[model samples]
Target: MQFEPGDRRRVLPRHLRPAPAPEVFAYAIRPARPADLPHVREIYNHFVSNSAVTLDERRSTIPSWREKYALLDRLGLPFLVAVSPSGAVLGYAVAQPWAGKNAYRYTVEDSIYLGPGAGGKGLGSALLQALIEACEQRGIREMVAVISDRGAEASIRLHEKLGFVEAGRMGRVGHKFGRDLGTVYLRRALRPSRPRRGALFGRSR
Candidate 1:
């Protein structure tokens, strides 16, 4: 999909065309790379610093982002990003284990964030749909989204539009910015890949 810059909190880099003509640009969604972590952190820290959309109160560091990237790589989970034609990281979507216990292996939690100028253009939905499909391909049975109830109505609606149903809500579970905050949980079941022939049987061939 194509987008024109609007309401950007920052100016576009010199590589991008100026705003008088409203430069039309496109972005590609693909697996994230190690170098993309910095951009990812920048985007995530924006929410952490400015809004109640996320429960986190501290800015994330590059080392932490690298650790997360490495852990997801080792676990065979999906970490995807959207990059503009000029190679700037526009946004990212990732999945992590829903719980540390063995029984929750088939379930994962989704996280998605877009850059300052990269929202409201179907980008979040695109990234989330891609994440869901990636999890399905990995034999995951369920995906969950835990969103803040403070100022995240857009996020809830986005998840709902992509078939996620409200699983439950937990009130006063988190405190950030000197206010009690809650979480709204949404879940979606995926079509996991079928097992290969004789995979469930004892080895007797």
Candidate 2:
């Protein structure tokens, strides 16, 4: 008797089972909420304590993250996260004022980090792109990313792929893990999400 298409007993051989499709990585990108701070801190502090990707030697705490969350909200800057279906924060990216001065109001610096096993799965790119779009919508002009020179080549390439241009580099700016580390600065000019309704210096005729 021919096996019916719905037959479950006919276990296909390992090679013959119409090769099971690759499992898809699933996550959603969205603005970070206050509750996500703990997870965000965990992701960043991992790099801080175990790697040279971040220059900070101090581990990030939930309190500090809360303060940051509040500051970003007050400034209307974007702090985004990628969360798994179960609501776990998988990664995060945030933009802060490039400098405290009023002259720097239109520019911002970005920080991004992924939780363990979250990299190489397109999460970094997705988070960065979403952050860029959010900034553009808020009328921000420029974005800067200062990435570590050690063990961060992937981050640099990801930024470049998203239209960031190398602005500059500084060698030996930081010493961590018994070695001097440097940073590569990349900059991207952001366009408004939508054009102004009127022509420059004049209204449409």
Candidate 3:
């Protein structure tokens, strides 16, 4: 996918556009690079340490995340970051296979995280919207979000704003920070499956 000037605006509909902020216009969304691992790890580790947003119990190391980046590259998946004009990593988003089975090939699970002081400015929405477009371009038929039930209203609202619907909820399936946490599942269909062509007049192509 191409990343051009003001492409973020083009990718997001007007209603979904984050309200203008001091850094909003100064930031651009683009694919993640190797150098971004430190900042990415920082943002992710924040959630791991401070919140149940992610079920990960340990902080992610640079080397470990580097392997993750490599796997995403190997699988041709979308791993994007939102960067400021000064090149600070504001936030990031990624899409991974929802399941490893061949039957789940057309589906993907999305994860998004923003750095401290980056919330409520629409950066999260922008990053997620861009990720959705990238996944759709790659022919992904469905997108899913697995969100923690504890104080994740913003994340849930973001997914709903982007057209995802609540598919299911798992009650107290996760244990984090000495408390049981439930998970909310949201799903959005990217596109309808193409109808398979039947053999014409009993002749296979």
What would the per-residue lDDT of candidate 1 be over residues 90-149, giving only the tens digit for each residue? 989999999899899999999999898888787888889888888887899999999999
Question: Could you tell which candidate, 1 or 3, scores higher by TM-score?
Answer: 1
Q: Distance (Å) between predicted and true CA of 162, model 1?
A: 0.3
Q: CA lDDT of 88 in candidate 1? A: 89
Off by over 4 Å in 3: 1-25, 192-205
- Candidate 1: segments with Cα more than 4 A from true spot: 1-22, 194-205
Give the per-residue lDDT of model 2 (tens digit) for 1-205: 5878888676667887676687667888777888888888888888989988899999978888899999998998888888887788888889999978999999999999999988887788888888888888889999999989999999899999999999999999999999999999999999967523211110111
Per-residue CA lDDT of model 3 for 102-197, tens digit only, reads 799889999999999888877777888888777877778899999999978899999999999999999999999999999999999996333332
For candidate 2, what's the RMSD?
7.5
Task: Compute the lDDT of residue 14 as modeled in candidate 2.
Answer: 88
lDDT (Cα, 0-100) at 167 in candidate 2: 90
Residue pairs with backbone overlap in model 3: none
| Backbone clashes, candidate 1 | 0
> Local distance difference test, per candidate?
0.87, 0.85, 0.85
Order the candidate numbers by lDDT, best to worst. Answer: 1, 2, 3
What's the C-alpha lDDT at position 59 in model 3? 96
